[model samples]
Target chain A: MDLFIAIFTGTIIAATPLIFAALGELVVEKSGVLNLGIEGMMLVGAAVGVWVSYAGLPMPLAIMSAAAAGALASLLFGVLALTFLTNQYAAGLSLAIFGTGVSAFIGKGFGSAPLDALIPLEIPFLTEIPVIGPLFFNYDPLVYFSFIMFGLISWFLYKTKAGLVVRTIGESPESSHAIGYPVIKIRYLAVMFGGAMAGLGGAYLSLAYTPLWVENMTAGKGWISLALVVFAAWRPARVLFGAWLFGSMTIFQLQGQALGISLPSEVLSSLPYIATIVVLVIISRNWQFLALNFPTSLAKPFRPAE
Target chain B: MRFQIERRVEPSSFMRFAAPVYATFSTLVVGSIMFALLGHNPADTLFAFFITPLMTINGISEWLLKASPLILIGCGLAIGFRANVWNIGAEGQLVIGAVCASGVGLFYPDPESALLLPLMVIAGMAGGMAWAAIPAFLRARMNTNEILVTLMMTYIATLLLSLLVHGPWRDPDGYNYPQTALLPDAALFELFDPMYRLNTSIFITIVAVFAMWFFTERSFFGYKMSVGGAAPLAARYAGFKQSGSIWMGLLISGGVAGIAGMAEAAGPLGQLSAQISPGYGFAAIIVAFIGRLHAVGIVLGGLLLSLLYLGGEAVQLSLGLPSALTSIFQGMLLFFLLASDFLIFYRFTPFPKPIKSGVT
Candidate 1:
């Protein structure tokens, strides 16, 4: 029972960053842009978040600075994909390379420094419960924020007028433009939002989860978040489930070792990536399911006709 | 006033050549500003980046040594890129290739046999192809996105390589180092010059360039693949199979990249280590684009990019600049090149007669 509660707690903590990033990407994709640079953006966020935190700023301010840095990095992609009309695939890739390089350069001196980790919240009423309290009520603020974000994103995507506009643009940018919606502006906003969320995810790693800075520290969590967005079929509610599934896979190695499973640590470490590929294959194998869920204008550059 | 972009009826051939040059010039200008901000002499930094790397004969040899794998991999990537098949997992393929080639070199019964080198090359190519075949099959059968699949496979490959080096392939005499034993003399490539690292592996790259040129420029199959890329519907109408292009494109690139991996293992490395490459596979993607997905262009692009790698090291030694600056410059060059590519299909002009704007 103790092990079960511990695993559940670890899973939720692990899933927080993915939740933030995948939700952001879901919104960006809903607005018809495929930003493959999430990994890069998260990396920049992690580095900047750690740098600021090491400078003795408040934790919230450090996280916010990370988000701003991510947004600024993503604007570089916006200029290329939205304004200059470069190939989004290539543009996103270059943005990722740019982010990795810039983050490494800026974070060189800060890599060895550690930041104060975010403390787990202790709700007064919930603290009396045994297993449930430890599993649910004892996580850091980011975990709660991630849960709230899922509900908010679901509401914004399906219930709001602005959400409808974003989805309509994703389905057919030309029609959206013809109906007088500012497609480019909306997409730019979505891209920036996605960037901010990816940044927040990065901050969660350095300021909350690991509490230390390392080169390329996000370590492909950004890519897993991308896979999570797909696994969820671009739905916010499903994203929560998918993020938990992947996050559990990440922690399973540690849990397995505790349970006396004797596999090599490297093989165990590879489980999440292998699981991602397998899930991707299973999801993509059904052509109709994929066709129905995938955004029609995803990865297509929208250049309004004059 | 303001500038408006206008579509060109036909792409300007002059701009086709001029865009890369313009991007190079702008990157230099931007790079100088970056260096000045870093408290270094801009001119000296730029010189170190571009010219200082090739000042000595040994330097030129080292440049070519690094460029060989990049050119080999870039040529393969160029073929796939031309057909719009994104196989960004060349890094994984390269790693697998090295693993297989080293497996042969380390365990082969007759290490001194003349056939050892050829066998290693074949095994390496086969290993790379086997790794790439996963994504090819997935994309062809399941309609999966190749970009994500390939990238995911790279992470898996890195882990697999680490597992092998740390466990089964660890050197016995050496104290817990994560690497294989040194390959035998017969497994190594012959040196072109004893004074430098230049080896016979470059001859393979030269031959590959010629083959790539002929295939892409003159072959009917290449023409079909290009049609498949440019107009998918038209290609379907013309009876060109999409699966054919995907398979051939991936296989060719995988095979070439595998051979390059074998060259690195048998040439300068002489053994398999956990870090056989410093992201040569990813850098090759930049080389493919800078060369405009053309065979001859890849040769030049490979040289230029290889020079950048060497120059980055030189600057680190001389100016005390962070080595990460190389990647920054490389990324900036690609960004500028992509931005300038707009000139291929559109021209910027002064906004004519502020007219009402609406969807046409």
Candidate 2:
């Protein structure tokens, strides 16, 4: 029972970054823009977040600054992909490269200075409950933020009027423009929002999860969150489910070791990546379903009919 | 005076040629400012970064030595890029290739036989193709997105390399380092001056460039793939097999990248390790794009990008700057290139705000 709780807690913590990033991207994709620079933005966020924390700022300020840095990075993507109208994929790739270099540069000195791990939020009355409290109530602030974020995103995406406009724009920017909606402006906002979330996800890494600065520390979590958005079929609720699912896969390495599995550690380390390919294959196998759920105008260059 | 971005009826051929030039100059100018920000004299840093590395004959040799893999991989990636097939897993393919080539070089019974080098080359290309073929088969047969799959595979390949080097392939005599045993004499490429790192494997790169030129500029299959890229609907309507293009696109790029890995192992590296590629696969994407997916352009881009690698080291040595500066420059170059590409399709024309309602 104790082992089960540990695994459960570990999975939620592991999944926090993915949930933040995927939920952010879900919104961006729903608005007819694909910012492939999520990885880049996340790195920028992670680097900036840790730097702020290391410089003796409060953790909340560090986290906010990380989100801002991510949003700024996304704005760079917005200028290239949204305004300059470069090929989104290539532009995003360039951003990834830039973010990686910039982060390494930023992280040059912080490698040796590990920050304290984020303290899990504990509500006094809620702490008395048994398994339920441990599973649902005990986690770092970001994990709980992810839960609130998941609910809020679901509410915003499905139950709001502004959400309909974003969805409409994703479906067809031409028609949305015809209906007098400001397509480019809304998309810029969506892209920036996604960037902020990705940044928070990065902060989760440097401040909450691992609590240290490493070059490209986000690793492929940024990319996996991308896959998660797809796996969730751009649904907000499913982003949480998919995050937990991948989180479990990440935890599998540790569990396997504890259970005396003799697999090489490298092989164990590779499970999440291999699982990504398998999940991508599974979700993408039904071509029509992807076509049906995928954001209609995703990755397509849209310049307002001028 | 106000200017309006007007779409060009025909893409400016002049800008098609000029955009990269413009981007290069832009990167240099921005790079100078960056140097100044870091408290170094901009002019001296630029000189050290760009020119000093190429002044010496040995430095020039190292430049070419670094460029060979890039030019080779860029040529391969350019084909796939032209065909709109994104195969960014060239890094993994390169690693797998080095692993295969080194496997042969390490385990062959007659390690000093001339046959060993040739067999290693073949093994390298085969390994790259095999790694790439996974995505090719998935994308072609199962309709998967190659980008995510390929990127995921890159991580797997890195882990696989780490596994090999750390476990079974650890050098017996070497003290606890994760690397294989070095190859014997006959398995290695012959160096040009014996003092320089430039080796015989450059011939393979030269052949690859010409072969790529021939395939891309003078072949039916190449034309078919371009159609697939430029207008997929038209390609399908014309009955060109999209699956065939997918297979051909991945195989050629993967095969060439593998050869690059083979050359690296045989030439200077002479062993497979965790760091077989220093982001050559990713850097080559920038090379291919900057080269405009053209044969001659890729060669120039490779040289230029190699200079960036050399310059990064040069600055690190002279100014004590961090090595990550090279990546910043590479990223900025691509960003500048993409921004300048706006000129190709649009032009800023003077806007006098003429009324359109009544006249029409």
Candidate 3:
């Protein structure tokens, strides 16, 4: 029972970052702008978030600044991909490279400094309950925020008029433009939002999970979030499930060691990545499902006929 | 004056040629401002970056030594890129290649035999091909996205290398370091000059460049793959097999990248270590694009990128700057290149506005 609770709590904490990043990418992909720079943006966010926290600012301010920094960094992608209509894959790859370099340069000074971990939010009455309370109520604010985000994103994507427009643009930008929607402007906004969420995910890494400013600390979580978006079949609720599933896989190294498993640490460490490939293969085997759910214009550069 | 971007019916050939040069100049101009902001003299730093690295015979040797793997891998990647097969996992393939070559070098009964080196090279190519085949098979058979699969496999390959080095392959005499035993002299490449790192592996790269040129520019299969990439529906209509292209493209890249990995192990490195490459696979993608995926262009691109690596080290030594700045410059160069490529397809013109009477 204790192990179960501990594993469950660990899974929630681990899942939070992916939840934020995957949800953001969901929105971006829905609007037909595939920003492969989520890894880069998250990395920059992690570096900047830790730096800001070390500068003696309040935690909330640091987190907000991280999001802003991510959004700012994503503008480079927007200019090249949306404005100039360059190849999205190449632009996004450059953004990742640039972000990784910039973050390392900026975060070099803050290497030794550690920030205070964000305290888990505890409601006085709710805390006294049994398994449900501890599992559901006892977690950092970001955990709750992740849940709320899933609900809000689901509502926004399915219910709102703006969400329909975003989907319309993704399906066929030409048709959307013919119907008089501003495709480029909407795509720019979607990409920026994705960047901000990716940043927030990075902030969660430094400010909550690890509470330290290590170089390249995000360590492919951004990429995992990308796979989650695909595995979820571009659905917000499924994204939530996929995040938790991957998050559990991430904690297996620690949990297995705790259980006195004799597997080599390197093999244990590779479980998450292996699981990712396996899951991707499994999901992608259903070609019809993927073809149906995938956005028609996901990576295609849209240029209105002049 | 307001400006507008107008799409061209046919891409401008002149702009296609000029864009890279323009991007290079733009990078230098921006790089100067960046260096000045970092409190270094822009001219000296720029010279240190571009010219100082090539001023000596030793420097030229080091330049070629670093460029050998890049040109080899870039040539392979360019072929795949031409087929629209994104094999970004060349780094993983390279690692597996080194591992295989080193395995042979370490375990062979007669390491001094003349056949040992040749066998190691073949093993390396096979290793790379085997690693790449996983993604190729997945994409071809299961209709999986190769980008994600190849990338995931890269992470796995790194871990696999780490496991081997830390466990079974640990050097017996070395004190707790994660690396294999130093390869025998016969297993190593013959150095051109004992004083320099340049070795016989460069001949392999030269041959590879010619082969890549012949395959991509002059071969019928190459034309078929390009047709598939340029217009998939048309290729299908013409009865070109998509699966065949995926397999051939990936296998060719894997084989070349593997040989490059073998060269690294047998040449400057002479042993398998955990960090055999400094993201050569990823950087070679940029090399392929910058070289326009042409054989000759890749050679120039490889030299230019190698210069960047050398210049970064030189600047780090002379100017007290962080080496991370090299990656920054690399990222910037790619960004500028991608941005400038827009000129190939479109022209910027001053936006025509409605002419109003001079009442205002």
Candidate 4:
């Protein structure tokens, strides 16, 4: 029973960052822009957030700084894909490379420094329950916020007029333009939102998860989150399920080695990545279904005529 | 109201070639500024960056040696990318190829058979093709996004490599190093002289350039791929199977890239290690695009990028600079390429003067 409790606790803590990142990408893709630079943006966020927090700032402020850094990185992507009308795949790739180079250049000075973690907050009524309480109520504020964001995003995407505008733009930018909606502006906002969420996810890793800086520390979680958005079919609730599932896989790999599993540690560590590919295969089995679900204008450049 | 100004002018073919050349030149200029900002002399650094390295015979040999894989992989990737098939996970394919080539070499360590090297080369190509088929199969059968699928596979490859080197394949004599035992001399490629700083694998690279050029420019399959990429609907109507094109394109590139990996392992390292490649897969991407996805063009791009890799190390040692500057310069080149592509496809025309408010 205690073992289950510990693993469950670890899963929630591990998943919070993924939830933050996937939810952000869900919003961005929902508005019809595919930003492949999420990993690079998140890495920058992780490094910058750690640097800020190490310089004696409060945790919340440090996270916001990370978000800003991520947004700044993504803004370049937005400009290239939107204003200049470059290929989204190429532009996003350039952003990823740029972010990596810039972060590595700046990251040389702050290697493996010890830092503070986000303060954990337990709710009063739910804290005393047996299994559910520890997993749900005993997490840090970021975990709770991630849950709220998922619910809020689901509601916003389905229930609000603004959400409708974003979806309409995603479906057909020309028709949305015909109806007097600002397609570029909505896409820009969506991309920024995704960047900010990815940044927060990055911050969670540096500030709360590891509490130390490492080169390329986010590893490939940013990419995984990007894939999760697709796997969830751009739906918010499914994003949560995918994040938690991936999060558990991540924690289990390390835990497996500690528990003396026969398989090599490196194989266990890479299990999450293999699982991601497998899931993609499963989701991709039905071409018609995917075509129907995909946003029509996703990754297409929007150009209006005079 | 939003409006686009189309500055319509037919650019000369020379201009088409000139854009990348200009971007390369501009990147050098901007890179000099970055060096100056980092407290280095533009002239001295530029000298160290380009000239100082080429001055030494050893440096030139190293550059050529490093360039062998870049040229081979870039040529293959150029073919697929030209057809709009994004195989971003070539790095993973390279690793698998290296592992297979190394495995075959290890098994045939004795000098009894000359066919051992040939077998390794074939195994390497097969390994790469197999790895590439994962994404190709998914994309053809299920409508999956190849970009995401390929990228995800890279992570899996890395993990698989780590497992091999760290577990079953770890060298027993070495003190806990995650690597396989060295290949015996019989299984490896040899140059003209032991003391000379050349490897025979470069011969393969030269053959690849001509082969890829012939395939892309002269072959029926190559024409089909280009036509498919340019106009998928028309190609479909004309009886080109979309799935077949995707599969063939990825597998051919993968096979070539895998051969490059084999060359690297047999020609230089002579053993398997945890870190088999240092972004060769990703760098090939830039080389393919900068070459304009043309076979002949990729050779030039390969040599130029190889210089950056060599020069980065040279400058790092001589100027006390970070090695990551190579990555920075590469990233800048790609960014500028995208910008130049805009100039290629679309011309800017000023928005017509707004009609007078009361005019019909």
Top candidate by TM-score? 2
Model 4 per-residue lDDT tens digits across residues A216-242: 788789888988987787778888888
Separate DockQ for every predicted complex: 0.81, 0.91, 0.80, 0.71
- What tens-digit string does per-residue lDDT give for candidate 1 at A155-267? 99999999999999999999999999999999999999999999999889888888888878887888888888888888888899998898898786769877677889888
Give candidate 2 regions above 4 Å deviation. B353-360
What is model 4's DockQ versus the real complex?
0.71
Which wins on DockQ, candidate 1 or candidate 4?
1
The pairs that clash in candidate 2 are none
lDDT (C-alpha) at residue B305 in model 2: 93
Q: Rank by TM-score, descending?
A: 2, 1, 3, 4
Q: Candidate 3's C-alpha lDDT? A: 0.88
By summed lDDT, the worst window of 10 consecutive residues in model 3 chain B runs over B320-329
B332 Cα displacement, candidate 4 (Å) = 1.6
Q: Alpha carbon lDDT of residue A289, candidate 4?
A: 64
Off by over 4 Å in 1: B353-360
Q: Which pairs of residues have clashing backbones in candidate 3?
A: none
Per-residue C-alpha lDDT of model 1 across residues B58-122, encoded as one tens digit per residue: 99899999999999999998888888899888988899899899999999999999999999999
Task: For residue A302, give model 4's deviation from the true position in Å.
Answer: 1.7
Candidate 3 ranges beyond 4 A from true positions: A128-130, B353-360
Error of 1 at B297 (Å): 1.2
